[model samples]
Target: MPVARPETSDARVIAHVDMDCFYVQVEQRKQPELRGLPTAVVQYNEWQGGALIAVSYEARSCGVKRSMRGEEATAACPEIQLVQVPVARGKADLNTYRSAGSEVVSILARSGRCERASIDEVYLDLTDAAESMLADAPPESLESIDEEALKSHILGMSREDGDDFKKSVRDWICRKGADRRDKLLGCGIIIVAELRKQVLKETEFSCSAGIAHNKMLAKLASGMNKPAQQTVVPYSAVQELLSSLPIKKMKQLGGKLGTSLQTDFGIDTVGDLLQFSETKLQEHYGVNTGTWLWNIARGISGEEVQGRLLPKSHGSGKTFPGPRALRSLSNVQHWLNQLCEELYERLSSDLEQNKRIASTLTLHASAFGSKDSDSHKKFPSKSCPLRYGVTKIQEDAFNLFQAALREYMGPFGTKPQGNKKETWRITGLSVSASKIVDIPSGTSSIMRYFQSQSTIPSCSTSGCLQEDVAVTPSASESCSEQKSVETQAAMPEEDISITDTLPDLDNSYGNMDMVPEKDVSCQSNDAKEFLTQSGSNRGTQTKTNGQRINNSKEKNKGMPSIVDIFKNYNATPQSQQETREDSTVSLTSKRANLSSSTSHSSEVNQEGEDRRETEWGYKVGEIDQAVFDELPYEIQREFRSFLRHNKRPNAGKSKGDGSASSSIAHYFPPLKK
Candidate 1:
C-alpha cells in the first residue's frame, strides 16, 4: 500500500527517460546491417529456437512479441533478424548491454538529478532546473527553438485539428502571464528534448521522454508515445487523460489488486472509482491503500523519485524448468562454480574501479521433491560473510547449499546417496553480493604499518631472537629506507662543540635524585618472584640470564647492583674536581662519563635477558575504563583475550573455594547480619 504525502501539488517538474527498444538498439549498433530491420533479441536458441526477450517496433508491427519463440517470430515476420545474447561460463552474459546503459546515464545526468530506474530507464527531477530556466530564460524571449521541442505531444490538445494543434501547443508554451505550473512544465519539455538529442548525438542511442508534475504521471506519459518521441501531461489535461483509462493500466494496479477491483467491485475504469467515498474504500482495502486509490483516481500522487545512479546489488541466475532440473550433487556443484566465478569477477571490478567492498554473499535456490507432499516445500535461502577470491566463494557457496539441503529434506529424507536414485531436483540457482561499502581513505597506510610490524623479528625470554620464516620486509620498508637516505643527503652539516654538550649531560645526571640501592634490590627480587610464580602456573616460561644471576646471589655476590652502576656513571672523581682548572682533563673526564651513561641506558633497553620491563608494563586492574574504551577495535580484542587468559585460574579458584568473594561483590554494600 502507498501512502500519500502532504505536499501533493503540481509545483514539481519531473521527467521519465526510456530507451527505445533498448536491447534491440544495442544489438543493431553492433551489427550495422541490422539497422532499420525487423529484429528481436533472443537467448538459448538451441532450445526451441530460443525465446524473444526484446522485440523491435518494426517487428511488433508484424505481430512479433516478447516471449515468442524465435521460430514463431520468423513465421510472423519472415525477414526478422534474431540475435542471441553472449554466453560465458555456461550462462548468458549481459555486460555488453550494461556498459551501454551506463553510457546513456552519463549523458542524461547533466540536466538534473537523475535516478536510474532500470538498465534502460531513468527518472529525473527537473524542478530546480526548470524554475531557474523560467526565471532567467523565458521561452517567449528566445529568438528560435529546436524543431524537436515543437514535435512533443501535448495531452489536452487534440491532433484532429493538425496545424491548429501545433499552433495551440506553441502558443501555450510561449503564453505570457500563464500559470507558474504550466511554465515549469514548458521548461521541462524543452530540457528533456535537449537531453534526448544530446544522448543520441553522443552515444548514438535514441530515447523517449515524458514531462509532468510528478513521477506517476511522468511514467504514465513516457510510454504514451512510442519509439523516439516524447509526451507532456499538462495539469489541466490530467482528468480527461485518466478518466477513460482502464484501471489495470495504472502502475501498481496491474496485478491482483486490479483484478480484485474489476471482479469484486465491477470497476472497469479510473472514473468508476470516483463514486465510492473514502470511508467506504477504507472499509474494503484498509486505510493506506484506500487513501492511495482515492488520490490516484483524481491524478494526485506523491511518490518522489530517488536519486541513484548505480544498482544496489548484482546477480546472475539461470532457471532449469521441467525436465531440465538438476538431479545430482555434481550437477549442482558444476553450476554453482560457474555462478560463483561470475560473481567474483564483478566484485573484483567494483573494488578496483569504485574502491568499494561487499560484505555479504547470499544464495537462493528452488527445488522440487520426488514425493507429492514434499514438492511444495520451499528451499530456504542462506547468506554468509563474503570472502574475496573465486575459490573461497565457490567453497562457501557449496557449503551453504549443503546446509540448506539438510533443512529442506527434513527428518524423513537424508543426504542423497551417489549409488541410489535422487529424491530431490534443483530447479533454480543464483548467487548475489550485497551490502557494498566504500573503503576508507588512508587504508593503504594502515596496511603498510601492519606489514612492517610483521616483518620485525620477535624476542623470547630465553635471550634469543627468532625470525618468522614466512615474514619478510615488503616494498613499504624499501620505500621508507630510500626516503631516509634522501633526507640525510638533503640536510646541511652543522659543527657541534663536544665540550659544551658533555657538561649539560653531566650536570643533568648529577642533579637527579636516585632510588635507594636497598629499595631497588627489593623491587627486583619481588618482580623475579612474581615472574617465577606466573611461569609455574602457565608452564611455558624460560629463565633469563638476569633471573639466573639474581637467584645465585650467594655465589656471584660481587656483581654490582643496578643503582650502583648508575651512581658510578654519574659520580665525579675527587682528583678531577681538584684539577678543575685544567680544562682539557676536565673535558676528557666529562666525555668518559657521558659515554658510560649512554651505554648503561642502551643495555637496560635491550631485548631479552638485559630488558627489565614486562610486556604490557602495567597491571590489568590499573587500566582506566575511559582510556581503554578509546583504543581501536583490533587492539581492544587483543586486550580482552589477554584478560580472559590470565583470569581463568582465578575464576576457577573462586568457584571451587567457597571462601572467595563473588566477581561482582564490589558493586553493592555488604548485607546486614
Candidate 2:
C-alpha cells in the first residue's frame, strides 16, 4: 500500500487564473456591442434556449442561476440578452470555446510551467520565470506604500517590461553567488503582474488570479475576485484566511463527509475542528479522510491540478423539467442517438489529435426513485465498451440501455404492484468515454514504462502522465510535500456511496447544506439543512428508525449483480471463437431488440453545420484511423454488425428523477476505518 506522505513545502511560484464569466465574456468580446449589459450564455436557444449555463455577475445578482430555464432568467431580469451556445452538428458546439481557450493558453504558457484547469481557468508555475527575471534585473515595487520603502524595494529593478528581463536574469542567476532567493522572488512578482496584464490585453478576457506556493491556495485565492483582479497569498496570509472558515467551505469538504462532520461531531467552523485531536478525528472518520480534514483545517491541501488541453471525456447532456417528461423508451432512444453523435464527434477529435484510444463507454440515466430504481435498468451509468464513431456510439449506447432494461426485466426488476406504471420520463441523459491515453505505437514496453516513470510532473502533490504537466505548489506553508504525511494523517475515516463526490465550497453557496430540493416521498426533511437550504435550518442527519426485516439480501444490496458485472467483465472479455460467435449472436439479437424498442422520443438534432468532418479530423496525431485500422478486421466487422443490429432506443423514457442544480456533493467514505 502507498504509505501516507508529507505535504510539499518546496518554495515555488504558482498562479491560478480564471476568466470572468468566460463564455459570456467570449460572446462579449466577439460582439463588443454586448459589453456591460446583463448578458448570459445559453446552451440551446432554439427550444427555450436550453438553460442559461453561464450568467455574468451582474445577472447573478438578479436571481439568475446557472441551470435556470431561459424563461425563468427572462423573468428575473427582463432585459437580459440570452446569447445561444454556438451551434454545431445541428446542436450546441464549443469549438469557438476551444479556440478561444487555446489563444489564452498560448499567452498564459508564456511564463513557466502552465496548466489549463478548465475552459476558463489556468495554473502556472513561475519559479524559473521568476528566477530568471531577478538574475537579469531586479524588480521595481510598482505600488507606493511609503516613499522610503518603495524606493528601497525598487532600487535595482529594470525600467522596461516584457520577458526580456527573464532571459537576461536567467543567464546571470546561474553564475551569481548564493542567497539570491529573495532577489529572485521580487522579480517573479513583477513578471506575474505583467503576465496578468498581457492576458487581459492580448486575449481580451478579464480574469482573476491567485499567486501562491501550491495549487490549492492558488485555486482558492483565484476566486477572491473576478473580471480582471489578482490576489497574492503570501505565506503570512495563510492563517487569517483559513482560520474561522466554515468546514464545508474548504474544497473537497462540501460533500457527504462535510455533512457527516457536522452530523457526527458538530464540527461546523473549520476552527471548531481545530479544537479536536487528530487521533480522535481519525477515530470518528477514517484514516485518510480524517487526516485530510485536520490538515485542511490548518490551511493545508496537497491536490494538484494537472495540465491538459482536452477533456478526459467528452459529454453532452440535459436535465428534464415539467412538461418535457419522457414517457416511453422510444423518446429515450431518440435523445440517446443525438447525445451519442455528440460524444462520437468529440471522440473523433480526440482520436485525431492525440492518437489516443478510449477503452470505456459510460451511460448515465435517471429515473424517479422507486422500486424500479433498485432494478438494474433504473439507475444511471449502465456503460459498456464503446467503439469510436458516431454510429458506434449510437449502437453501443442503445445496447447498454437494452442490457440495463434486460436486467430490469429479471425477477427483482420492476413489477406492477399497485398499477404504478406512471410514465418514466427521463430528466437527464449524459454519454461519456474514458480510458484515454497516448498511443506510443512503436515504443517497446520497457521504453514506454521508463517514459511514463520519467513523465511524473515535478510537483510535490499531484503528478501527470504527460510531458507538459501542471505542478504549481501553493505559497502557503501548509501546502507542501513535507506536510503531505501530516495532511493524510489528519484525514477521517468515512463510508460513502460510490456515486457522490465533493462539491464546490465557494461563494455560490455559503454554510448551506446541499439537500434534495424536490420533495420526494422517501425523504425525511427532519435533517438539519441541505445544500438548497440556509442557516441553522440545515445540517441534520437522519437514520432508519424501524426494525429491519430478516430479508437482509434484499435491503442490503441496493443494486443487482448485473451492476457489479462492470468490475469483473473487464478481466476476461472473451473466450475466443467459441463464445465469440455466440456472444456476437446474442449481442446482435439484443441490439436489434433495443433499436426496435427505442424508436421514439428523440430530441436534439444530430447533424450540425459546425460538426467537423471525420475525413480530416486528428487530435495532435493519427490515432483514430491508424488505431482502428490496426485492429483485426474480423473484430471490426463483428463490432459493426453488432452496432447495426442493435437499433437506437428512445432517450426520453430513460430520464430519471433528480435535480441537477442541488449543491449536495456526496463523497464515498474511506474504508480505512
Candidate 3:
C-alpha cells in the first residue's frame, strides 16, 4: 500500500532507468555474435532445456516469452539461441549479471541521488540537478540540444504526425514562458539522455529512461518506449494518460489488490476510480490505502527515491522441487555447505569494498513430512550471531539447521527406527547475512592499544577464553578502592588477543557469553570437562589436612595488575592510594576467610554452583576508570558504546552508592550464599 504526502512533494523531478532485457544484454555482450539473434537466458538445461528467465527483443517479436522453457521458445522461433547461466557449486551463478548492473549504476548515480530498485533498475531524484540546469542552461536558451534528447517520446503527443514529430518535441522543450514544472521536466529529459549515452559508451549497454514530476509517473513513462529510448510524462498529460490506463498495469496493483478492485468495485481502469469519494473508499479499505487509491486515481503519488546504492543484505539459496527434495542429513549438509560458501564470498567482498560488517546469519528451510497430515507444517527459520570465515559460517549455519530440524521434527521424530526411511524431505534452503554496519573509523588504532597492554596468552583452539589468568581482586580490599581494583581486574585479556583482524571482533563481542546455547549441546567431552573444572576452581584456595595452603607468593602470575600496567602513565596520588587500599583489603579478607572455610565447604560448593548459573559470559567491566580516562576520545566513546550493548539487563538494580565500587558491582552481580 502507498501513502500520500503533502502537495509540495509533487514539485520534485524524478526519473526511472531500466536496463533493456538486462540478463539477455549481459549474455549478448559476452558473445558479440548473439547481438542480433533471437536469444534467451536459461538455467538448469537438464530440466526441460532449462527455463527462460530473460528473452531478448528479437525473441519477443518471434513470440518467445519469459518463463517459457527453452524447448518451447525454440519451438516458437526455430532459430532461437539459448544461453545457459553459468553454474558454480552445482547451482546457477548470476554474479556476472550483477557486476554489469553495478557498472550501469555507477554512471546513473553521477546525475542525482540514485536508488538501486533492483539489479537492473534504478530510481533517481534529479530535483537539484534539474533546478540548477533550468537556472543556468535552460534547453530553450541553447542553440542546439543533444540528438538523443530530441528522440524522447512526449506523453499525450502523437507520433503519427510524422516528419514534424521531432521538431514538435524540440519546440515543446524549448518553448518560452512554459510552466515551471514543465521547464523542470525538460531539463530532466536532457540530463537523463546524456546519462544514458554515457552508460552506453562506457559499459556497452543500453537502458530506457522516463522523466516526470514523481517516481510513479517516471516509472510509468520509462517503459512506454523500449530499447534505448526515453519518455517524458508532462504535467498536462498525466490525467489524460492515466484515464485510459488499465488499473492492473499500475505499480503494486498488478497482484491481488488490482483483482480486488475489479471484483469488488467494478473498476477496470484508472478513470473508473474517479467516481468514488475518498471517504467511500476508506469505508471498505483502511484509511491509508483508500487515500492512496484516491490520489493515484488522479495521477498523484508521493513516494520518494531513497539514496542507497548498495543492497541492505545479501543471500544465496537453491530449491529442490518435488523429486529433487533432500531426505538425509548428509544430503542437506552438502547443499548447505555450497550455499554458505557463496554467502561467505559475498560477505567478504562487501567488507573489503565497503568496510562494513554483517552481524546476523539467518538460515531458512522448507520441508514436508512423508505423511499427508504433516505436509502442511512449515519449517521455522533460525538465526544466530554471525562469525566470520567460510568454515565458521558453514559450521554455524549447519548447527542452526539442526536446531530448526529438531523443532520441526518434535520429540517422536528425533530418532527414526533402524532401516526405516526418513520421514521428512527438505525442499528449499537459503542462508543470508544482514544487519550490516560500517566499521567505526580509528578502530584499528584502538585495537592496537588493547593488544599492546595484553599480558595473558592468546585464545585457545576452541576459541574460548583461557581460565588460568587470575585477575580478580581478593576480598580484603577496602570499599573505597574495591571498585577501581575490580574494574581493572574484570577486563577479559582474551578479548584483546582473540584475533588480529577487526572483522573478527564480532566473534568475541557478539557472543561474549563464551558459548551459545546451540553450540553447548555439540561440544566435545574435553571442552565440557574444562568448563566444569574451571567453574569449580574460580575463587577457591587449595587446602590440605583441613588447613588452607598457600600455593605461591606470586598471586597475580598470568597478567600484571592494572595498577602496574598504568604506573608510567599520568595518575593522581589520591587515585593511586585508593587502588592500593582496595588491593590490600581484598587480599587480607581472602586470607582470613581461607583459614575458616572447611566447615563452610558445602556453602562454598553452593556458591560456586550459583556463580556458574548466573555468569553473564564476558567480564566486560574490568578496566580501571583512571586507565580508561587516559584513552583517546574516540576510543573512550567506542568503549562506552561496547559497554552499553554488552551489559546485562536489569544489572543496574543493585544498591546504589555514589562510589566506583558500587558502579563496578552493578555490572558484575555478587553471588548469593
Candidate 4:
C-alpha cells in the first residue's frame, strides 16, 4: 500500500502524458507502410494466436482491442497487421519500446521535472513552467493561440460539433479576464500541446496529455480523449467531474479497495466517498489510507511527479501456462539462462551508460508438482550478490532455483515414482537485478588506496562474455545499431575521466502504491506495484551477502556443479578478516598469524600444483588489473581465493564454508536461525 503524504496544494500544475498505442506507433514508425492501418503488437504468435499487448486506433475502430488474441484481432479487423514484439533468447524483448520511451522522456523533461511512470507513461510537474508563462506571456494577450492548443478537450465542456467544440476551447483559453488559476491551466495546456507536437516532429509519435492541478486529476483527464489529443481539468470543474465519477474509476481505488467501499459503505461515486468523515474512514481503512481516501474524494492528491528518466531495476521474464510448463531441470536452466542473459545485457548498458550497478540478482518462478495432488506449492524467489557477468548470473540463478526447488518439492525431492507423476512443472520464470546504485565517480583515489593493500598481487585484465555478446538487440535487428545501440556506440568516443561530471541517475522516488481509476482487480493493483511488491513474492531470505548460509544438503553432494563454479565469488577481504578473528578467539592465537598466501605443506597446497580456486576459475594474475581494481574488496577476495590452489578435504566446498577459504564461501547465505 502507498503511504499518504501531507495534504496536496490545489495551486500546482501537473500533467500526465501517455503515448497512443506506443508499441503500435514504434512498429509503425519502423514500417511506415503499416501507419494508418489496423494493427496490434503481439508476442509469441505460436501460443493461442499470440497475446495482443498494444492496438492501434485504426484497429480499435474496427472493434479490435488489446485484450484480444492475434486471431481474435484478425477476426475483428481482417486487415489488421499483427506485428510481433522482437524476440531474443526465446522471450519477448520490450527494450525497443523502452528506448523509444526514453527518447520521449528526454524531450518532455525540457519543460519541467519529469517522472517516468511506466514504459509508455509519464507524469510531469509543469507548475513552474506554467507560472512563468502566465507571468511572462498570458494566453489572453497572445496574438494567436497555436492550433494544436485549440484541440485540447477541456473537461466538463458540453458535447458539441467538431468545429464549435474547437472554437469554444480556443475562446475559453484566450478569454480576456479568466481567473489566475484558470489562466495557469491555460498556459499548462499550451505547454503540453507544444511538447506533444515536438514529440511527433522528432520521434514520429503521437501522444495524449492531461493538464490539471495535481497528478490524479491530470491522469484522469489524460485518458478522456483518444489518440493525439490533450485535456485540461480546470479547478472550477473538479467537483462536477468527480461527483459523477465512479469510485472504481479513481486511481488506487480501482481494485478491491474500491469494491469494498461500494459493497460495505454503499459508496458508488467520488461524491459518495465525500459523505464519510476522515475519522470514520481512518477507523475503517487505517489512518494513512483513510486520510488518503478523504483527500482523493475531494479531487486532491499530494503525490509528486518524481524527476527520473531511468527504471529502478532491470528484469526479463516469461510466463508458461498449463501445457507449456517446463518439466525438467535442464529446461528450467535453459529458460533461466535466457532471462539472465537479457537482464545482464540491460545491467551492462545501465552500468556503461548511466554509471550504475545492481547489487542483487533475484530469480522468481511459479511451479507445481506433477503427481502429487497436494503439491501445489509456489517456487520461492532467490537473490544473491550480483556479479557483473552473464555466466556468473546464470550460475547464481541456477543455484537459487535449486534452493527454491528443494523447498517447493519438500525434503524428499518429489512425489514417489510409484505415484506415476512427473517431478515438477514450472509455469513461470523471471530474473531481475535490483538494489541498483550509482558507481561513485571521482573516487579513484579512494579505490586505489584500498587496492594498495600489500598482500594483494597485481593481475592481468579479463572481459565478461556478457559484455561481448549483444543479447538484447538495441532497436531491432533490422535497424541500424546507432538508433538502439546502448553500448559505446551511443557514448562519446573519448574515454570518460573519473572526475568528469555525468547525469545523476541516483535520485529516485520512493515506491508509490497508487491505484488506477479503473475497475481493475486487486491483482492489477499488485502488478502496478511491481517494483515494491515483487520482492515479497519470493520466499527466500533477503539478507545481504556474507550474512547467512543456505543449509540445503544437496548443494555439494556431487561433482563440482554450476553452484560450485562461483562459490564464494562475492566474498570480501573484510569477511575473511572477520572469520580469521573468530577462529583465533575460539581456539589459540595460532590461527591469527596464518599467512594470506597458500604456501602451506598440505596436499591441497602441494608444491608446483596449479589449480583455480574461484568459482569461475578466474585467476588473480590473469584478471584485468583495471577491472579488478574497480571491483569491491569482497569480489577481489573471491578472485584471489580462486587463484589459490588448496587441495583440502573441503576444497570443493562452496562459500559460507569456514574451512574452505577462511571466508564465507557461499554466495547466497542461508536464512537466519
Highest-scoring model, lDDT: 3
Candidate 4, residues 1-673: lDDT per residue as tens digits? Answer: 5457674545888999999999999999999999999989998759668999999998999999887898898888899999999999888999999999999999999999999999999999998998999889888778888889998888877758888977898888878778878888999989999999999999999999999998999999999897899999998899999999999998888898999999999998998989999999999999989989988888878888898888898999998888989876657777887898788878767865676667667889998666644666677786655655564466567656655665676556634333334477889999998877654333221212221211111100000111111221111111111121223233332222111001111101011111221111112211111000001111112212211111111111121111111222123334433433343121101111222132232332221122111121221122223334334433444334432322123322322322222222223232111
lDDT of 2: 0.49
lDDT of candidates 1 onward, in order: 0.61, 0.49, 0.64, 0.62
Q: lDDT: which is higher, 1 or 3?
A: 3
As for lDDT, the candidate ahead, 2 or 3, is 3
Q: How do the predictions measure up, each by TM-score?
A: 0.66, 0.56, 0.68, 0.69
- Weakest 10 consecutive residues of candidate 3 by summed lDDT: 531-540
- Candidate 2, TM-score vs. the true structure? 0.56
Model 2, residue 409: C-alpha shift (Å):
4.5
RMSD of each: 23.7, 22.8, 16.6, 17.5
How does candidate 4 fare on TM-score?
0.69
lDDT of 2 at 268: 79
Alpha carbon deviation, residue 612, candidate 2 (Å): 34
Residue 273 miss distance in model 4 (angstroms): 1.3
lDDT of 2 at 60: 85
Candidate 3 residue-wise lDDT, 490-596, digit = tens = 44332222121111111111111122222222222222111111111111121111112111122212322112222212233344334333442322133223322
Show model 2 residue runs off by greater than 4 Å. 1-5, 44-50, 60-76, 87-92, 140-188, 369-380, 412-424, 440-673
